[model samples]
Target: MKTQKAIYQSSLPSNTRNKLVLRRTRKRFNPKIFINRTIETTAIVSLLFTGFTGAGAMGCWGMEIAMSSRNWQHQKNICLGMMLVSFSGFLGSALIGASFSIQRDKF
Candidate 1:
């Protein structure tokens, strides 16, 4: 079996045998890409949260409708609040994503 160094060196030309192999440099942190990724993640998470809370609110409202008691009012209110908050977050993130796309296109 060939050694790892010998396998790698076998592919190079004879003229380059004495030259040093330069490794690729690491990329610098880009804030624009980071911000775009963050916005995309936030949008997806908020959309999922909104869907869950909206379903909960619907379920609570359904229970309230089927039962004669008003015990689900507080829970329904909480669900509605959470749903609204998550929906707003989703919208805000979506808007930010759109703005970023527009900015990228402009340059």
Candidate 2:
């Protein structure tokens, strides 16, 4: 059986080696695609966070209403604040996505 090093050492022709080098060198970074994907990912994550926080806020509000407790009221306020922040994040990401889509169409 051929050893791994021996197999690896079996040299290719110069043309094939040059082709491989050229292929490696041809890769390029695309900022537009990268930014679009990043915005999309942020939008998705923030939307999820908004959903979760909104649910928590509703639950706290319901408990405060049912129990008439000041502690629950405070917790409900905090949950509402978190939900609002996450919602804002989702909105910002959505705006960025929309702007990017428009820019792409223009170009």
Candidate 3:
């Protein structure tokens, strides 16, 4: 019981009775880690692309249903907008990915 108490006290860093220091592997700080993590832009852009594409798909589906009912006039504009946005999002993602690839290759 005394040994157990002594061990417990030693485990505490601030304990004055039996001193024990817990050492951990220290990783050197790197500026690159901060810069790399701070601007995680790819995820945001990918999510934007996903949302735009999903909205576009919904718009196209709406247009299809509207056309079937012969109410195509109003849906035409919306559907077109959706398709355009979807196309742009897909194009943008592709371009961004390509640009990154090119940059990696260049250096």
Candidate 4:
């Protein structure tokens, strides 16, 4: 009973505990610094490419929705098709984003 009480007392509030863990963990595993400018530039370019492509996909989806909403008969089919396309874009964006993260060693 006394040992259990001690353990309970040692446990911190959830927020403070999480912050402490994060701070300590970050300090332990610091990221590597790239020596070449082109490495950084390439990472930035990759990020931009992925971001813009994903955004463009979403924009096209938006246009489809807007165009489709005008009619009742075609709207349902168009919206369903757009929704499927958006879901695919979401998955593709996730994969592309992961590739960028892998290259940057951010994940």
Best by TM-score: 1
Which candidate, 2 or 4, has the higher lDDT?
2
Residue 59 C-alpha lDDT in model 2? 92
For each candidate, what is the lDDT? Answer: 0.84, 0.79, 0.57, 0.52
Model 4 clash tally? 0
Candidate 3, residues 36-80: lDDT per residue as tens digits?
Answer: 443346445645765765566576567768567545544555655
Instruction: State the local distance difference test value for candidate 3.
Output: 0.57
In angstroms, how far off is 53's CA in candidate 3? 7.4
Candidate 2 residue-wise lDDT, 1-107, digit = tens: 32222122227786564343312223457998899889989889988988888888899889999999999889989988988888899899999889888887996
Clashing pairs in 4: none
Q: Locate the minimum summed-lDDT window of 10 residues in model 1.
A: 1-10
Predictions ranked by TM-score, top down?
Answer: 1, 2, 3, 4
lDDT of 1 by residue, 1-107 (tens): 32223223546789987676654445668999899899999999999998999899889999888884577877889999998999899999999899889988996
In model 3, which runs have C-alpha deviations exceeding 4 angstroms?
A: 1-70
In Å, residue 100's CA in model 3 sits off its true spot by 1.3
Which ranges in model 2 have alpha carbons more than 4 Å from their true place?
1-26
Worst 10 residues of 2 by lDDT: 1-10
lDDT of 4 by residue, 1-107 (tens): 11211122238776665442322122233344333333455546555555655565566567667676434434445545655565555565566656756888966
By summed lDDT, the worst window of 10 consecutive residues in model 3 runs over: 1-10
